[model samples]
Target: MNGQPFQTPVEYLKGVGTARAEVLKKELGVKTLGDLLQHFPFRHIDRTRFYKIKDVQDDLPYVQVIARVTRKEILGEKHTKRLVAQVQDDTGVMELVWFQGIKWVEKNLTAGKAYILFGKPGSFNGKAQMSHPEFDLYGSEAAQRKGNLTLQPVYSSTEKLKQFTLDSKGIQKLVVGLLDQFAREITENLPLYIVNKFKLMARADAYRNFHFPEDANKLAEARHRLKFEELFLLQLKLLKNKVLHTQKFKGAIFDKVGPFFNEFYAHKLPFELTNAQKRVLKEIRQDTQRGVQMNRLLQGDVGSGKTVVALMSMLIAIDNGFQTCIMAPTEILASQHYQTIKSLVGDGFIEVALLTGSVKTKDRKIIHQKLENGELKILIGTHALIEDKVQYQNLGMVVIDEQHRFGVEQRSKLWRKNVIPPHVLVMTATPIPRTLAMTLYGDLDVSVIDELPAGRKPIKTVHLYESSRLRMFGLMKEEIAKGRQIYIVYPLIQESEKLDLKNLMDGFETISREFPLPQYRISVVYGKIKAEEKEYEMQRFVRGETQIMVATTVIEVGVNVPNASVMIIENAERFGLSQLHQLRGRVGRGAEQSYCILMSKDKLSADGRIRLNTMVKTNNGFEIAETDLQLRGPGNIEGTQQSGLLDLKVSDLTTDQELLMLCRKCVEDIFAVDPQLAAPEHQVLNMAFQDKNAGLSWNKIS
Candidate 1:
């Protein structure tokens, strides 16, 4: 048997018939023998030592005892029914209970039969007992020797699987059967030289040890080998795609820092560029001048002056006699960018236009003419920028703000707008952890601006209970009296049964009653409102017509009010750390001292308490992001699942940062010598890449 044995339908296996195969496919996605082999255990138990029944303590993690079943009884009726068995070792006696599958237990358990019982110990009516424990017959000589097993792998199975006799033990037995039949048929994917260099265990040995380890050392070595293989294959694909992209796609060369960029830095720059910002600009300049398309990610925290760096880079493109564009995710953000860039460039130096869904038909016609006639130097808009009708004359560079909101297909459409894709710069205010960034955006260069501008004060954050409402109101009144604005954000637009948090409408009504009409004006905004109405309310708040904006998370990303000195989040415990940080960023835009009040109920879960305390402790976005990753794991992080790169089976992005770095270094070394993996010794890697990349789509934008 070769690879064909692994590919055989799981229904044909010795223990798995048609009935169990259906349940296995529906419950665990194990359709073929190979799928079953790859379903690694989530945890392992040490079964080498056995404890006496008298020594079993409630606090012990898990213990096994060799005992004889002396009696069995079925109690209760119908759904309330349960089966209990009295088992006695030489020293003491204990009880075993089963609430589910009582009929099966009543039929199988026999009196005067010696068995091995394994489970967590607990007390019931002053007697030791274990509910739903694992058991095996102890009379057989083979079973007696196997009872001293060093390690046992425990897999994840569903209750539905348990009904069909397909629990973790059943799955383990099936894997054991498969291994007995086909372990020797497993082929090596990595070259022997590389395996020797890393001192890795043989591929067959790794599979065997991962399922049934001989000792702790062998288990550790097995895990290391599998994790390295996973990370290495992923990195190899990304690097190969990058190398192929650079060689095939030609970019417009912006070889000179011409008068436009020079003039803006010399005279028009509003503030001195921070060292971090200067370094990022140098990187972008180098990419544009290299004559290859640049796919770079720009990460900066809120209020860190990213827009200024973006404007300066756009000016370089303009100086080289090519057009540029910036696409934001929302209409308000697009309009804000258009106004900011227009003001920065001043009146006659460059022609800039704003194109959005709300733009009038006649105005759009004029903008189109200017864009096609090479008169429009820059165009800024939301998704409207990618429309088929919008054409550009020599579009050189593209900048996307908050790029995660857009899908890969939507962004790739912009690349199709030009003959050769323009140098791409994707910017995000959400700080991603280094491990996550390397895995998600491995094919792109990354630049981060970590420092804030001079003369800026850190926002003061405080956690407040709901009982502190009056004091919070007093502080808001004081800020208002000082001629500043405020934002009061709620978590939901309407009340929900699943969540007991306050909604936007209730908060608006309460704030109105507290502050009254003539003295205080509040604007309400939410997702359900009409687009035109929402924009009108937002504009009113922007012009300072309203002293307070009571809204939902719709205002979390785009709204920027410099005079707003306070951010009050209602039921802050309901939000994640990242969202809380983004909401806190809405304020603290100006020189006035700013504050963020996190209002929550008095009682909170442990994780919720940690999230709130983290916000109150530091204003660093990266630090907050790392804590968020640890608390919520990578799956819950925003926009990460959509990338399709985090479908990891063994390695964890939160804890395996060092392993990921080492894998990257290995790829760099391998590529330095065999860029295409065409050497005879490297043929194994090339074949593996072909199999991995056959169905996978690599649509990274440049």
Candidate 2:
């Protein structure tokens, strides 16, 4: 019918005429033959079981039955018209109603005729009823497909679609129209060796069985093959990008560990580095020593000392006579890094400067001049560091904190600041699940600081319903009496009419009334507050002038107060797992034991309960991250780009982790054997990369 069978427009299909095809494209994005094939069923239902009308329960998703049409009638007229049919089984009677497509549906109803019915049951006046129930002559195509005893797929459809005869049954028919063409059109994307080795179904058979299986076993096999293919192709493309990036972009070599690094480590180091930190530093050291530009992702929990690792790596660059910069997502973070690094280096061992939008023009110009003249050894700032006026003489490394906050384009600007791309170390406190990291940051080498510094006690976490508000306040008072500050965070800055949760301003008022000023000063900060005011409030908390800091998620990343011992999150269920973990990290920085109280409403959704329970159970950021990945699913996780490789149709990162790991290993094994896919057996993968359905445009999340 066209250049390629799969590429043919859906309008040319057997059942889908121009009108139906237009509806399909507009509603479900099913335009080409391939798009229709890829629209998988969310679930399948058994057709063998038929329930008696008397046994029909509202709790059941859908009730199937064989019954006789006792009476049929059309009510109202024109736009307000409806068709109602009363069906009777051996035990009882049920009403089947259709509000839309009344004229066409009325023609199909025949009173006193035996037929099969399928629909979600609802009770009306103690009678079982189904609106727009599916029906056919008792034994004629009752399963909706011919000559099959397997499960019937239940495809999702909209009310608009049902009006145009494009319900789930309609869509199934369209798919069935293409069944005979699968073997002729669906070419094998995976090599024969891979298929045989993995015990995978053939490409054509997989597609057919996935849509309409002859049996449950065929369906399971089809799913396994498709899921593996989705994950494998994505992994293969990621590995290819990693190889190409390493080859295309040359890295600045930093082989020496000079005075700046050794001086701090020997005399000025604040504490002993954890083995995890040391191991991560060694990984960075190895990445930089290689000639290829290092693109490494450094992951650590809030107090895991990633900044120190980053500083040490930068010192390696400085040792090799190259300048380095650390960029943060916010100005507050930039200033904090500057202060921390300055105190750690013990005044003038190595020059460090901060540049942000709030920095005065005079100071900014001086920093810019120093940077270009090679007088500034280390620069930490927000986006201001990437301005056109800010140029480095020999920028060798760029460390990005909370790298997900910055886009790919902004990061690329730093690479352009030098002739050759600088070594990149992207740091994130949000611990990503291993499966997620492999797919999201697969192109970059990853190093994780999993262990916290010794002697730092884990923050004690607890969950409390809103009924225990007084108890939470008591804990806050107790903490403050012990000379420790407290952090009270809210989900919203102001009252939300849509959400019935406590807001920051209301919380501040509540705390002000309870704690009462002069003796206990509280700082209120949020996104809408002026930057200077927020900083001043934060400084007050840091200096112990304010015993309580009432704010929203604005301080989730930037604020680090060793004296802040208690973190009370109002509507904690509203916050995600990683966010709760980051907030918990704000405390426990000091020797004093810290506490994190998660406050939620009594009525919580299952996901909300899981999130709160996870926060209360352990402080392991990675463990919390894995649970979050499972709860929210890969697509809903914040900061993770939802398109490209993450737009997984067949493979779910949550439940299919084993397959994900296996597929990644397969990609690794293939690359080990033939990185370029030049081998005859590997050529199929190269072709898959070109096909969207096979590989789906393997791209990294920015």
Candidate 3:
């Protein structure tokens, strides 16, 4: 209370002594008055209305009533003991029970005393009851004022905080106390001109209204203002990072699409390129020729030909007399890329080498020698490529496949391979939605290959219950009769008592029994399997020696078998939408019609139903991605949480996409005039940026 109100610690606040303050800091990350003020409520309740005791229904949400305690009794044994009080209003009576804190309830309750009660109504043996309701003596100052009580904010609390009497209501009381003392001291962070243009509420007013709004409209306006502020700051940071990268980093110029690229495109190319692939390749070529380092993301669906675009981009780099490398998250994927690229560049057009951990010591020495001597035009490997012994001579470009699997530090290692850091092109077959791409990878230029190759049929998706297993078996047999292979994927590698999931080994046994291994061979693969054994199983499936492959999600990436026309996922409800999509992508690589059959129990959760229905409705990856974002929120979606891009407090990427876009546009407008924010009009923004981003790790590679 002595220094600035915003900087005062919570321990100094009224009713929040040192012990409670420590709990607040530990549980909710609220240490100071400013932190308490910013901890906005997840939801609010209208306390202006009250329900009669007779009108209390089991389905009704939180309701308040003025009632008198008619009788009180303690029931049940220890650990299950409870204090029950019969409360009655003019209309009727209802039971209020406290299973926890029974001693406190017993000490506080008095028969014939009037009180205001509030909680969700529940039914106990056909009688209306409320468990652990909030109550205060009627006519007391603590009682909520009827008609004068507007919106009451409910804050989130943890179990530890609850042990110290800091539940939602308790936290709300602390927030109210802090706001009452320091409302005037909460200063604005946005510039006046921007605020006036947007007609935004002042920061102080927004915080106050967010904690306890006078009405619903003011609450909405306050939310909009705060969400805009959060998104605006995030966009400003991302845009600044982009400006820093482009202005400071210089890249090698691949000015020519020379003979190596043209010859492969004309003669050695296996098939015609899709329009989407051509468009993405053109974008990459433009970036490489600009002499500014290209930090681009190549997003495509399972079989949309992202690998071809990456290969062509690498060829462009090699044609410029510079070596290039492709980094995969796993050896299987690296080997796949190396073989595909080598085959596409037939007749030794480019000297390509694989440098995975499995490569022999002598082979590693040869790869190192050739790479240093500039004899290796293209190198492909896993994390082994980042080893200290690996050095590149004039490395011009780096292509990272499934880039989210690697950390920022591991990917940054490739940047140091050259004096002027090599141009980066990170690729993912996981189709990221536009909103997600803008926020998560806003610093990178994104190029998407949206179309699949010609004559490739769309994979038909369906949901099946356990009762339809015989039907599913018949379909599998029919597909195998047509010389097509099949994949049976499970959610777990071993049985777990907690989850009734179909494990991989059990699934392999079931399939072997049904298919009879002498007539039909089945290969099993999972993460626990050795690298050599997994590769052997995968090769067996790829070569069509095995008619079926029983595996876990380890086959979700890198395994390519065009002959595998059907993907059957057991316990599909247990898998996420992204994992389901990735697993489905393992099929439909050839001209024949493919299918993804999702097998689950008869019952499903709402989200599970949405995922199954969505897969059945469309083959478009972007649409599926948008739906996934909505269903899972930003944090649970694959890499956003790990990248720290979704470390947002107020703004939601799913519901606030328009606000995010507006904020990005506003940042662009500001930077157009004051690139460094040195002008007087942008001084507030500069100060706010420093305060927000201080000591933050901004090493994410888009």
Q: Estimate each model's TM-score.
A: 0.92, 0.90, 0.89
Per-residue CA lDDT of model 1 for 456-519, tens digit only, reads: 7999999999899999999999999999999998886345722423356667778999999899
Choose 2 or 3, whichever is better by lDDT. Answer: 3
Top lDDT prediction, candidate number? 1
Q: Which residue pairs in candidate 3 collide?
A: none
CA lDDT scores, all candidates in order: 0.87, 0.85, 0.86
List per-candidate RMSD values in Å.
3.3, 3.5, 4.0
Candidate 1 off by > 4 Å: 1-4, 17-19, 59-61, 68-90, 95-115, 120-125, 130-139, 144-148, 493-502, 692-702
Top candidate, metric TM-score = 1
> Per model, how many backbone clashes are there?
0, 1, 0
Rank all candidate structures by their TM-score, best first, as comma-separated numbers: 1, 2, 3
lDDT tens digits, residue span 293-329, model 3: 9999999998898888888888888889999999998
Which candidate, 1 or 2, would have the higher lDDT against the true structure? 1
* Better candidate by TM-score, 2 or 3: 2
Give the TM-score comparing model 1 with the true structure, all chains together. Answer: 0.92
